[model samples]
Target: MSEKKGSLSINSENIFPIIKKWLYSDHDIFFRELVSNGCDAITKLKKLEMMGEAEIADDEEFKIQILANPKEKTLTFIDNGLGMTADEVDEYINQIAFSGAEAFLEQYKDKTSEDQIIGHFGLGFYSAFMVADRVTIETLSYKKDAKAVLWDCEDGMDFTMSDSDKADRGTKITLYLNDDSVEFANIFKAKEILDKYCSFMPVEIFVSDPSAEPEYQTIMEEELTDKDTVIEHIVEPAKTEEKEKEDGTKETVEVEPEKKKVKILKRPVSISDTTPLWTKHPNECTEEEYREFYHKVFLDYKEPLFWIHLNMDYPFNLKGILYFPKINTEYESIEGTIKLYNNQVFIADNIKEVIPEFLMLLKGVIDCPDLPLNVSRSALQNDGFVKKISDYITKKVADKLSGMCKTDKEEYEKYWDDISPFIKFGCLKDTKFCEKMSDYVLFKNLDDKYLTFKECLEENKDKHENTIFYTNDPVQQSQYVNMFKAEGIDAVVLKDAIDQPFISQLEQKNENVKFVRIDADLNDSFTEEISEDELKDATEKLTETFKKALNRDQLDVKVQKIKDEKVSSMITVSEESRRMQDMMKMYGMSGMDPAMFGGSGETLVLNANNALVKYILANPEGENTDIMCKQLYDLAVISHTPLNPESMTAFIERSNKILEILSEK
Candidate 1:
């Protein structure tokens, strides 16, 4: 092919301005991009060696060294990796493919972030232009007997390349900081950025020492004398005599003075760890090591309840540590807890996509080199791999939980309080994940014992004939729970905001399994069979009397004869109606819309077997009957089912009046 030489063309003169203004939100990332490029070069060289295309020397070390000089306002990153030849620089640098990175990524579409080569677009190196006034690259390819080359580019899109006499095996990039970006030249400042962004890079990185202490040597002072005039120092006669006496009589005495030495600390900071914990095999890691890693990453004082070490290589290269924190209440306080790292470097502030919203309750780090990073590494584009990774994490978490439940029931129950919200959230948000998680999702019965969904259902199937799950507002539903207990049935307490919707979805997924609110009704039909004929006859007469006693036009009342009579009269809202109210509350609505339930109001069910209801119905004319109905309705209202406050207050006043009348008589 004939030699072709041309300069890069820019679509707009605003390109440099865009790079400086909006391309990078933080100027410190420029160092990260350059250092990453250096690491990539070394990684490529290693690959070449494996391919038998090149033989690397034994003494050859692939590392990046950072030098910062505030006086000269210069920062340099030197790398002994695969350097670019003159032609390569001309094509990659002098000619900017406005869409090179995007086009290259599209061309190698099937390749994941781990497979695709870094700096394909060639703009990452130019990121230095974002913070520097002028950037220069001195490089020599790894090919046998390669000539050195120099490439220079200012903040603008223009650049120049030429042959240089400098002998270098790799590349050296020098950044001349601009007036506004002078902080980049400060060794301390540059080290901080490196530590934050490149703490686990594959290659070693070094920065200059700006905080080195000075060494001092003591020198005896000599007396000054004029030329040809020799001055002899004269000591005091008494001191001389004492010195002579001490020297003659003394055994040798040695005085040890503190040594003064200068030490070059080199900023005393590490920019990278070649091997991260997550990248290692689980067999090689211990529980204490995992816990220590968690503490280092999260800075949390409490140890993790449990963790899932995810290491997969098949579909996509993924690895991470997910910790189930000891979440004691504060369910809504989950945010910015799960961090996302690409190649061991933090990429995003919050990994919302990588971590399911439900898994936000978990706190840990997920490092996957397969996750694509843009020029700035500020955000990630969603792809099939991204979705797959999310699904994989969900399944892994479910597996860990299932194993915990099966292996250690007591410990699992101990963590139930912390993990329940996360499970409920997952069951509500992700349908597929919910299906898998349901197998291991736990429910704590009134007796404080934990059971998986399947186990709980199996245990209750024989007694109740149906898989029944119910949640109660423990304080207000205490009476309702007690009533269920009276019937020899067990109930789960779900008080979290997400529990209601979660159980609703779960009910839809499972077969013969139903979720009911404890206060929905006192009827045993939820757990046992009741004769419809007997129930209908008893409910008919009671409904008529309850309607008459309670102003029918004002109060909504329904009488049901249930097997459980411990609750004489309990107020219960239908499961459907209560769900609407919960949804309304979640959406910040002002109470549930009555129209949504077709104007169907909550009903107050009275147990026909209760003596209180029997006496109130028998002696309708007596003074006690009216007082009893009012007291019974109020009691139901206090059970957490909604009631009109006005009616409740009126009942209290009437009860006081009846008491006064009885006392007076």
Candidate 2:
């Protein structure tokens, strides 16, 4: 081929600047595009070799080599894959948007699928222009006696092509780093970019710095592989140590034998794990492997609760591992990373289009070669196909949870406290998931036992009918909890923030079922059944006496007779009103007074059997009567909720006066 120069096939000169600045979402994505192109090249070469169209040695290892030269202000990417001839370069490189991978797939359509190729648009090669002022490519095709070609472009619009003296059967791309992009020429920065985008690329990748002095490391021969380069061998002499005999005499003993070590050039480890754990079948993976992969990808030291391995090929090719991380606390953010990939090249993290919105609380990877990615591959093209993928993922997670509950209830319950928030969130977000996981939702009861909603309702059916009482804070509601326990009632614990909305959704789903807090109401079993007339008379007298003594005539008071003689008074908040107030607080409307909606929705219930109530009722005008009434009201208020500053101070002073009266007596 003769030396030639021509203008690029781009329509306008402004396209180069647009491609450099706005084509990709991030400036660092150029590494991903260029490295993935190399992966495609190697994959195509392997396919040809398998079909006997090209010859490749069995011992040959195909990889991508990245060399950063800070001194020279240049970065180079080398790949031992199917290189291009001069005509091929002119056709693919000279012509913008003409994808070489697409052309090869078209040529070999009958033999292979597009899954093996990572690059679809020819603009990937031009991504180098994003970080470089000038770019050059030297290559020799895999064909026998193929003439090497050298292609260079300064403005990315015009190019010069000529024959080259390059001897390798692959392509090498060199980028002259721009002043703003000089950081890419540093070895550490280059490696960081490779780790971000190419951690699981299909082809092995290695980063290097030619300007630094070569370092050497010693490795045992048993630990060496074909990838390691041996510099020299060393044999350490055996060591002797003094040992004490039974008679307390010291003796010499050989404690260690000679060891052999191989010194080799310390090369950077391969930045890519070609076969990630997600690609393997579930049956082929072990428990430890999933945990290790979770730690490696997410850098989370805490182990995951469990994982679901997704492997599908029938409808569309997809492989991944979805890990339900063990939440350490309720305050910890539930947002998790679900890395989206095409083939093995990472595209983005937490892509809600392919992963269900609820599944964003899980940490894992999903590689779907069939994803409908746009030209730059930075975002997904919203379509029905993407919806189907999201729905598929949601279904898989639901299936895993429901299956675990059915087969291994003990283990599922063990992970419930750590994983319940995720399950409840999932149920609230996805209807299909809710339908599948409804029966699997486990609630921790006050007895520290796990029970499903049906079990809870069934166990308390005769006592509370269809209502299942729960406690938000068992400590603050300990009096109510103990009262329920004394009455042989069961209350589940719903302490998580998501539990509020979750139970609301559950109520909508099950019309007959209701979730009431333990402190929301007083049970009938705690009160004696008195005649209507007598109860009305006692309620009227007690209500007037307490209201007058406390100086609050609008207070709602109820009188219950002869129920636990030691119990004096308690407060109850209406469940509906409490829920409304909570909703208001959640929406930042807590500043509004509760009386604006309805008069506090609180009722002070006084036990007629207690001596305090009896004394207050007998001597309504007595000096100590007001003190006892106010003390009882304050006690009830403190038990139910915190007392206001003024009310608390008054209550304390009144208690002290009563103690002084007792001392004087």
Candidate 3:
């Protein structure tokens, strides 16, 4: 064969620029594309071997070796898979977007399914140009007596092919790192990219630095297995230790029974897990394996509360594990990574089109071989099939939760606090998920007991009747919580940021149900009936006194005779108005005045049964009457919510003055 040179079979002159600059926005993904192409080549060879068209040794190992040479500024991907001849390279390499895997599948369509082929677009090889100034391919076909072919292309448009003395059986792609992409040629960077995209690929992957000395690890002879390639064996001398004899005398003796031999091996670790936990059957996976995989993949040391293993084949080939990680801090955002994969090749993280927006809060991996990916595989193509996959994932999550609630109520309750945010977010985003999980939703009460919506509604039915009470901050609202407890009333805790909107969504779905904050109102159980005339008189007097002392004529003041005598005054805001304020704050409009969006609808409830109310009524014009009124207002406001800086400062000053008066006494 003679050397041949020609222009690449590209449709337009601007194609190379489009492929390098505009196609893949993320440059690091070039590693994934090239590695995945190597994997496909290996898979095609295996398929050929299985069909008896090719012969392979029983002990032969197929792997993809990534060599990063920083000094030479070149990145290489070598695969011991099906290679191509000169003619094959001319047909596949020179063509743009003509997938060799697709062509192989077409030729062997009757023998194998397309599930194992990772490359749909032959352009995956051209992705090398994304970070390379020059790309070269050296391949020796699996066919007998096939001459090795060397193909090189500079600027990704013009190419040269010639006969080569290569001895390898598979393709080797070398990328001369451009000035801007020199970082990729570093061994550490190469390993990082491999770990990110090829961690769970079907074929084993190893990264190495050719310029660096070979790394060796010593392993005990007993620990050495078939997978290891031992370089040499060394025997260690037995150690001696002082031992206590049966007669209570110390004696020097050999601790080890015999000398131990250890084997030294090079490159003992593979970068990718050929069979990830997600690819296995759920019945075959153990709790420990799930936990280990979670720690390894997500790098989250905190144990996940639970996980959902998704395995399906008929409707669409999908396999994954969704982990509900235990939230370490309440203030931390619930955002998590949902790595999307196509046949074990990672596409991106948190792809909403395939992962379902709500599932983005879960740390997991979903590999759907049937995913419709665009040329770059960075984004999902708009297709109804993708929606089916998304819906399938949501259904699986809902099924897991609802099933747990039915059969494992105790364990379900234990994980409710950690996983409730995800479930609630799902309920808000997915209608089908909400419908399935509606009955399984658990609400933790003030006593830390978990209860469903029905249980909560039933427990409060006799007293509050259809009104559901909840508290956001149990510590800040302890006063209200204790009052509710004393009155034999119950309220669930909704502390997560998502709870407010979630509860609103719940209300919208269940029109008859209502959610009110613990501090939103004074329940009827906390008060006793009083004569209408006496109540009216007390209300009028307290309103006038507070209105004058606070210097606000329009202040809403109500006097109620409460059972708890220790209670002085408390503030209450209408549920609607409080929700409005919360919405404003969530949208970053908290700085706006409440008056601008209508009044806060707040009212001061003065407990008539308390000694402070009696003293104020008896000494309306007393020397300390105005001081007592202002102090009561501040205390009520403080108990209800945090005071603004100006109000808090005034409250502290007033407190200090009162303390001074007491000291003088």
Q: Which pairs of residues have clashing backbones in candidate 1?
A: none
Clashes of each: 0, 0, 0
**lDDT for each residue of candidate 3 in 1-665, tens digit (9 for 90 to 100):** 89999987754543556555556667898899898988998999999999998888899999999999999999989999999999899888887655453453344334322223234465677778888989999999999999999999997688899988899799999999899999998989888888888898999998888899877888778887776788887888778999898999999988776656665656447988999999999999999999999999989988988899999997889999999988854568888999988899988889878888988988999999988786677666646898998899998998888999999899898888888888898889889998999899999998988888899999899877788999988887888989999988889999888898898897887899999998887867889988999889888888888888889968888888889999999999988888888888888987876667784668899999999999998788888889899999999988888998998898899999999988999
Model 3: clashing residue pairs? none
TM-score computed on alpha carbons, candidate 2: 0.89
Error of 2 at 69 (Å): 1.4
Comparison by lDDT, 1 against 2, better one = 2
Task: State every prediction's TM-score relative to the real structure.
Answer: 0.73, 0.89, 0.90
Model 1 compared with the native: what TM-score?
0.73
lDDT of each: 0.71, 0.85, 0.86
lDDT of candidate 2 over 1-665, digit per residue (tens): 78889988754544556555455648888899889889999999999999998999898989999999999999999999999998899888887766453453344334322223334465777788888889999999999878999999996677899999999899999999889999999999998989999999988899999998999999887888887899998887789999999999999988898888899989577989999998888898999888888999999998887888999995888899989888866568888999999998989898777888888988989999999886678666657888888888888888888999999999888899989988899888888998899899999999999998889998798877889899998887787888888889999999888999999988988898899987676767888887899778878888888888878858888888747877788888888878878988999988886778773678898888899888887888888887788889888887788888998888888889989999999
| Model 1 Cα shift for residue 468 (angstroms) | 1.3
RMSD (CA, Å), candidate 3 to true, equals 5.4
lDDT of 3 at 510: 80
Which rank order by TM-score, best down to worst? Answer: 3, 2, 1
Off by over 4 Å in 2: 99-120, 220-262, 530-554, 598-600, 625-627, 642-665
Candidate 2 lDDT for residue 78? 97
